[model samples]
Target: MRKIQLGTTDTMITDYCLGTMTWGNQTPEADAHRQMDMALAAGINIVDTAEMYPVNPVRAETVGNTETILGNWNRANPARRGDYILATKITGKNAAFVRMGEDITAASFTAALDASLARLGTEYIDIYQMHWPNRGSYHFRQNWGYDPSAQVKSVTLAHMEEILDAADRMIKAGKMRYFALSNDTVWGVAQWMRLSEERGLPRVISLQNEYSLLCRLYDTDFAELAVNEQLTLLAYSPLAAGLLTGKYQNGAIPEGSRMAGNGDLGGRKSPRVFDAVAAYLDLAQKHGIDPVHMALAFTVQRPFPVSTIFGATTSAQLTRILDGLDVTLSGDILDEIDAIHRAHPLPY
Candidate 1:
């Protein structure tokens, strides 16, 4: 695996991150540990998880189990703790099960950090991210409901500063190294950067937003911001919730697939999604390329700095993706991909 600088920080993360969003539920703990060992052996160093994980269902009972599972791995391999860069998130508002549906205030941020540290059984976190902004985000396939007029700039800026102050306090105390954002907007990131610069506070190092061939929302607005600000993108769901793998094709959902559990895959199961996925799958087959590899490599080969955060519920699935790491898209393949994009742009 190639190492890339994480923003302006000295920390270096692998070109891809190992994601464990299904650890305690669809994936057994033993399999999860094995997955970690395999990922580390493959040179995957950055492990991303969250306090509200194992979340095909996001049950109240299963909350925090994923961190506990990761903590178990850490305790067992205490000597290898430094072998990976761990990134976890604090659940944002409307997660009634998390902090009673609280928005991220300074107090909430501090408390969440402490709880995450305790759950992970670690004294320090490499990256502490807010799962989403309190002001709400237009991501997660929720763009149809977006209304920026509903937000007040004063309130948003105040929240950003308060959280930055709290993050500064945490950094001073050695609880966390850097702060990041997930499911946020370009404006949101710009404000965070501006506030941190003006106040001399700890700045955000990364943005954990969803970016894939099917989801090109980041290519334009985020592309400009990321290059100018050096905001490293941790692209999640690079497969578009497994749509690119072609498993959910022909209206057939695998027994243990994400769609079978959450059906609609957070609104990604639109009628047109299958059509867009078919175009990509055909392109991959036409060129003897694994669809998974093509999807992941597309994000990795983007003109900007990005690391794809990919997940697996089973080791077999993980191996399939790992096996194709060397596959790169040719100019002709990329041209065809772009042509497909032009034809089926915004399929979902």
Candidate 2:
């Protein structure tokens, strides 16, 4: 696992970030801890979680359990706490279970940060991200129906300032190392950059968005913004929710699999998606590389600096992902992938 500079910050993080979304749901606490240990041992230095996690079901009862599990690990390994970068997100609107589904105001921001720190048993977080824009985002398979016509720009700017001001206080108080965004747009990111520059608040160092061969939504404008702004692209679901792993190929959904519980795989179960998967799987087989490795490697080779975030419900899945950390795609392989992308772009 190679370490990359975390945006303009002095801190360095692994190119691969361990995702804990399954911690309290599909994965047991012990196994989650074991996976964390295994990830660290494999030289992965970033662990990402959220206040609302364990998302296969995302029940209200299990809402902060993932961070609690990570906190327990941190408490037990106090001496090694500095060895990894910890990142977590605050849930946005629609999450009625979290602070009454309030938008991120100054009060809610402060409260959410304090609650996250308490759940993780950590004094500070390396990265604190807004899970989604309060105004809504085009992510999560909503691109086709996405509409932001109702958002008021002035209202949004004021909200950004309030949140950034709160974030600055948290930074000054040593409650967080950096502020980040998730499921946001270019305009949203630009506002944060502008507001931070003018208001002397914390500048966003990263953006956690879904990016993969199947999902090239970030390849154009977002990629340019990241490159010019020195923002790290924390690409989540780089494997397209296991579609690129070939496990679900030929209509075979292994028991206890992500698709078994959520048959749509978060709206990725289209016939076109399967067609795209077969193309990538065939390419991998032809090149004598694991399709999973090929998919993961492709993410890191993007136009901008990226730290691909991957999660696993089982240790075997974790091992498979870790094994692909060292796989590097050659020029020929990349060209073939590009060709594949052109033919089956945005299948889902």
Candidate 3:
């Protein structure tokens, strides 16, 4: 329920952001609207979505349905359009189904922004993000096999400059208020910062990346960048794909759950993952805290300021997470959590 300054922008947003990646796929329109209403009433003012969403299966048919759902909500609740900060992403390089999966160019940027605006039925987006860098990223469990040898620095910089130029034009045109990044690396962020300063382009206000008790990659160099650069972290998957909720433990996959649809939860089903989840669940029990709240609260309490993005496939799940928004871990609990991290680092 706390509000924080959105990077260097004049705008302020809630520490919790409602994620709509499952809106049209796992959740229905009426349920999605109810979730939004609940979130706004709970003082959560940010809603995060993307052009390629409803992503468990990520079928081409459901690609942009998430935004359409949000657009419908905005249209129905015209008086509350400005009540929340609307943030969405432009899918990058690999989504061939998305406009032939063309890379982000000046023309593509313009076109994508226009199309997104039309779909959301909004005059402007509060925060527009590049879903991933053209050069690729090491997130999404890709670190083990990630290779950067093929990336040319000169070519990457040229592309970044061009995209930033287009972003500046979009900002001037009032299509979006702020620009951010997702699934980016330290080097990529550095280049964007340097280019924006030198070229008077739009500066990145935030970085949305996967972060949770199971994934602590952000605590490394990215944490330093976040602190020094004042780049607030909009942490997605704060529950570690729902593993941290303790429901996936001991092979208890509930029907209609994320794992039920995508069996492995995107390569998250490993022997070590269950072990790690068990440890966290036990820790939560020892402290008498709900595992879901414990996981989300821990993320928002990171050294660098963070806004934890949470998604739900059902209204019950959304209500459970929202009910615990006020839960804060104590110093003892945090210290014990650090000890657990040391013992079970990178279990997934």
Candidate 4:
């Protein structure tokens, strides 16, 4: 694992980031701690979690358990906090369990930041991000019915200012170092950049979005914004929720898997998705590469600066992925991948 410069910040972070969305649900606390240990040993320097995590169910009961599990690790590894970067998100609207589904205001922002700090048992966070735009997003398989016609520009601008002020306060108070966005659009990102530049608040450094060979939504406009603005892309679900791993292929849903519980795979499962997966799987087999490695390496080796935020529920999965971090895809493979994309783009 190699490190990269984090945006315009002086800090350097690993090209890989550990995701803990299933830490407290399918994975036990001991296993979660062990995964954290394994991540550090493997040279992965960043761990990302959220206030509403461990979420196969996404119920009220386990909303904050993932953060608590991570906090438990911190309590035991008291001296190793500085070894890895920490990032977490504030849940946006529709999660009634979190602040009764309220939008993010300056007051709500401060409250959520304070709560996240308490749950992680950390004084400060390296990156604090909005899980999604309060207005809504085309992410999470919602692109088919996506509509932004109802969003009021004046309201959104004021909201951005308020949130930026909230971020400014948190940074000044030593609660967080950077602010970021997740599941946002190009316009949303542009506003943050403009507001930060005009108001001189904390600069937004990164954007965490779903970017995989299976999902190339960010390749055009978002890629342009990231390159010109010096914003790093934190790619989530680079494996397409384990689709690219080929485990879920041939209509076989492994027990205790995400698809087993939520058969839809967050609405990503369809006839076309399976067809796309087969194409990529065939490509991997032809190249004599593991699909997981090929999937991850493709994202990390993108033309844009990106760090893949991948997660595993068990030790075997974790180690297998760690072992393949060095597998670099050649020019032929990339060209083949692009050809495959052209054949079956956004199948889901």
**TM per candidate:** 0.99, 0.98, 0.99, 0.99
lDDT of 1 by residue, 217-237 (tens): 999989999888889999999
User: lDDT per prediction?
Assistant: 0.92, 0.92, 0.91, 0.92
Q: In model 2, which range of ten residues has the least summed lDDT?
A: 54-63
Which stretches of model 3 miss by more than 4 angstroms?
none
C-alpha lDDT of candidate 2 relative to the true structure = 0.92
Q: How accurate locally is residue 302 in candidate 1, as Cα lDDT from 0 to 100?
A: 89
Candidate 2 on 166-280: residue-level lDDT in tens? Answer: 9999999999999999999999999999999997789999999999999999999998999999999999999898999889989999998888989899998898988899999
Q: What pairs collide in candidate 4?
A: none
Off by over 4 Å in 2: none
lDDT tens per residue, model 3, 1-348: 788889888888889999999999889999999999999998999999999998888998888999999999998988998999999999998898798888888898788888889889899998999999988989878999999999999999999999898889889999988989999999999889999999889999999999999899999898998888889899999998889998888889998889999999998788888888888899999988999999999998999968999999888899999999999999999999999899889987
Residue-by-residue lDDT tens digits, candidate 4, 1-348: 678878779988888999999988899999999999998999999999999998888889889999999998998888999998999999999889999999988898889999999999889999999999999999999999999999999999999999999999999999999999999999999999999999899888999999999999999998898888888999999998888898898888999999998888898888899889999999999999999999999999987779899999897899999999888999999999999999999888
Model 4 weakest lDDT span, ten residues long:
1-10
Model 1 poorest ten-residue lDDT run: 321-330
The RMSD (Cα, Å) of candidate 4 is 0.7
Model 2 quality (TM-score): 0.98
